[model samples]
Target: MAGSRFVGHIKMWFFFVPLLSVALMPAAPDPSLFDIPDAEAASVASSLGEVRTADAIDTTNRTFKHYFVATGLVQASMASSGETQIEDGGVANFASRWVHNFWRLVYRMVYRITVMKYWLLGMLVFGIAMFTDGTVRRKVRAAAAGYVSPLSFHLAGHGILLVFGVTFTVLIAPLPLIAPYWLAIAACLGALLWKAASTYQ
Candidate 1:
């Protein structure tokens, strides 16, 4: 149920981005791609019993509405399988593609830590401070004051993990996640860090 809700939220988020984009754009289009012959349109309308008039009125040329395009954009979620069809080969490699992607992301996370100087330095300093300085740790805990009890801490920790997981998924997403998404990620990580700083040792 939680998984369904998560996916629903992701899809809802996907649905809004394209709508927001269109609202900022110029106007409606008359694209040839969505166009069909007058005869075909009339036949379709008649078959669907949607034609209200006695005669099938013909417009200059019909095209699909922007709503179709906007909703179609929701299909581009990161969790979706990129492969439309499997390749023909002697040995068709039957493997879970998302599992491979999951490990690849994990490797990338670790690899970035090793290669990026700022990340490495920050991790080292943060780790040292959390482990060594009791006052600093307490101050950090005070920053994330709401999740004080163990139950709240655990719940917040899980929530942070879910957000981080979604962030990782967005790495390979087709949608333009943009700056706001990154800002949210930064805030989430900062909260997690504050929570982590509350250590007894």
Candidate 2:
């Protein structure tokens, strides 16, 4: 009786093992799960195009920017949702300061060139010459009537002072962009001349 009962238990275990294995297996993914209607996709695409067009137009006007939604329905939904709460845990102050400093730096480069224009321009020219090969710099130096090597102390000293002069001149100079870009080309030539003269001196 004991041997017969042990054989019956083994038979039950064999039946349940395959059943448990099948139950634990993952289901196969169906391809049709994320299918969206064609009409809905087309509407969304049109709305995106409208938003892009408005943004492109706004960029040309530098004074102020206006945020525009493509569809009235979208705007209505956003208005109903109200403003989102951004949880920065007091990091907002740092973020604001960072943005302010960034814009200040950019403004100094663009509209407020009077302060550091020469220094910036001179550094730019010096950096270019320094990073370039000696032979190439020698050729340019010869053209400029100077013997400053690409990595020489003289080059750096002149370049350092050159920025001030260039920035001063750029601030005082009136460089208007002419039709067909002739004046712009002239201004570029003027810059090259200035660089050469600074190095030559």
Error of 1 at 13 (Å): 17
Tens digits of per-residue lDDT for model 2 on 148-182? 53334444434434433343333222232112232
In order of appearance, the predictions have TM-scores of: 0.31, 0.21
Q: Highest lDDT among the candidates is held by which one?
A: 1
lDDT of each: 0.41, 0.38
lDDT of 2: 0.38
- For candidate 2, report its TM-score: 0.21
Please provide, for model 1 over 89-180, each residue's C-alpha lDDT reduced to its tens digit, 9 standing for 90 to 100: 51222223433333333333332222222233554565455435644766676777733466545655556556655654543332333334
For candidate 1, give the lDDT of residue 180.
Answer: 46
Point out the worst 10-residue segment of candidate 1 by lDDT: 56-65
What's model 1's lDDT at 96? 32
